[model samples]
Target: MPTGLALRDPRQQLFDAAERVLVRDGPTGLTSRAVTTEAGVAKGVLHRYFADFDAFLTGLVLDRIARVKAQATALGETAGTGTVADNLTSALMTSFDPVMVSIVALIIARDELRTRLRTAGTARFPLVGEGSAMIAGYLTAERELGRIAPDADIDTVAPTLIGAAHLLFTERKDSPPEPEAVRKVVTTVLAGAMR
Candidate 1:
């Protein structure tokens, strides 16, 4: 059966296949062959798009980072539209999703991949930092609308929320945190900060 991936942009198809391999088989299971097989493309297809496996891995990480950043950037558009906690939970969900967690774990565990990423000038994935800044910006906007306490330390609150979400997602390996739990985390964090 044709996977139809061959019809998509080769790079994106390879990226999607890499993600599926990473999620289902973990980092050790990810290989050029694996991605090509999953993508249902010729084994040589990935090599044609990327220099090597490391390059592909770095590209995948960077692409995911870009997506996270975009999500964070769009979060500001939700300002004042819903309960602060609800809005925040929705935004943070992307960071803690199963795919993201697997990617983070893979990047951290592989020295070669990490070195390649760092050499590419992305030593650290900036998703958390960027997300914190975006959240802080959103909080500031909310404060202007009187939704948050005027004296709330948005800088601190933003990183705190990110950290809490990271912990919740990373620690609960067997059973992912539920949406309500995510909401609760956001609510508890904002209780003193929101008006």
Candidate 2:
């Protein structure tokens, strides 16, 4: 164990290291050993903090969910402030950034991890589900502000927009799409809803 690790937040260190492993090696490559090694902490450190590898993964996924929720809150507050497409474009980039997109891939690849997340009552599909909800909330607020069609079905629009954004982002996992590319998808998906 590094003497310095005791002074820092081990859980956060592990989570960040796990994130790097997932992005670098993909989900199949995410092992307890990999995380500990990447973190430069002793293997025992992970076990000491978490019950098992599943527990550690659960903690990491939950931490990511919380981050998405924070982004959602920030986006929700922006209702009516900017063009709807512009707000959604920015939110999509933050919501589906590289790490987040990798986390989504991880959730899809690991049945055990997905089961653990569901058992813990994290969002149904984690990032994707939460991302949809985030867009839904923002679209709802815009509807109330009369920036969108009064009859716009925000529920449908939200998921459609998120799904489209997710596709665009995942298409090139090495780099995020240009903001203009995201904005194009946002505008296309929300065309029916926007005023």
Candidate 3:
């Protein structure tokens, strides 16, 4: 594939390198040297794309946030025939990537950076919001089909379901929760809450 000077924006290179380093070695491995080496760029090149370490870190978080939101938004926008659990499952599952979790952890730890990110509006991509919206959509469909309870308030319920998913995905252990365990938590919560 065509890359390097063929790519006009060096920022994309930094982002791509950041993604790889983050997935492979987690957030602590995201150094300018590491990213530059991964991108095959001179160490100084990282500065041209990013103002500093903090800026690059902010961008890293924002990039993952955008991806998660995009995934949830696309799933929400799609017109699919399935049970409420299925649609909710699709959106909730996307939130499990290590990339997003690592970003969230860094943002939470760096209050100054997190503050700048919030003020810069990089922290408001609505990742969880998108998942909630997807759940709301599914619940609406279920209600229309009389499969979900008429009294159910999707706006409230969706976030509750997403919150559970967040906790399950955030588990830090030598052995992370299995896919089946995560699915069970999501499905059980949705089943009880939907109808």
Candidate 4:
């Protein structure tokens, strides 16, 4: 008799496999059978956990959003304890993965993932609002410390700054910007907006 593969819980195995496949191959590669094979489970395991390919895709997108939110959460919790520039820099830097950013930008450029995100409504996703708020929180701390002007509207400035950073860094595949240069953009816009 042939030896069998070691068994693990189906749902855990599916999610773990899906995560690996997504990280390595991204959205288009997340097929049910592929995930099951990666986990050494039967093909039917994916269907048992997720209703369909669409359902699995949705879960994967949401999981990615949750991970970004967790990073933003950690940044938010630490925002007040550091220098304003340092805190904001840390928060923005966490979201800028050159490889994944390029992949997502290409996917959106082809109108593949963008259509889904539009239909899903970007605001409903945790990462957007959570990231914006985290930035705003840091700006507010800056204002309190008089590092920014007294009349800064953190609510508007924060989202605008985050949007600008995302636009510049997340959608391009040219030579990447330097860390110090990126930090300058953050500090300059933040100061200008506050001033």
lDDT of each: 0.82, 0.88, 0.67, 0.64
Query: What's the CA RMSD of model 2 in angstroms?
Result: 1.3
Candidates, ranked, TM-score: 2, 1, 3, 4
Model with the higher TM-score, candidate 1 or 4: 1
lDDT order, best first, reads 2, 1, 3, 4
Which stretches of model 1 miss by more than 4 angstroms?
A: 1-6, 115-123, 173-175
Candidate 4 stretches with Cα past 4 Å from truth are: 1-30, 33-41, 98-126, 141-147, 171-177, 193-195
How does each model score on TM-score?
0.84, 0.95, 0.75, 0.67
Backbone clash total for model 2 is 0
- Please, what are the lDDT tens digits per residue for candidate 3 over residues 1-195? 223454467787788887778667766777788888888877777776678878887777667666766665565555346655666666566666666666655666676667667776652433455456656776676677777778877777777887787788787534456656766876776665555
Per-residue C-alpha lDDT of model 2 across residues 45-145, encoded as one tens digit per residue? 99989999988988998998898899989998999897898999999887887788888888898889899998988778877888888889888888899
Clashes per candidate, residues 3 or more apart or on different chains:
0, 0, 0, 0
Which candidate number would show the highest TM-score if scored against the true structure? 2
Compare candidates 1 and 2 on lDDT and give the better one.
2
Supply the global lDDT for candidate 3.
Answer: 0.67
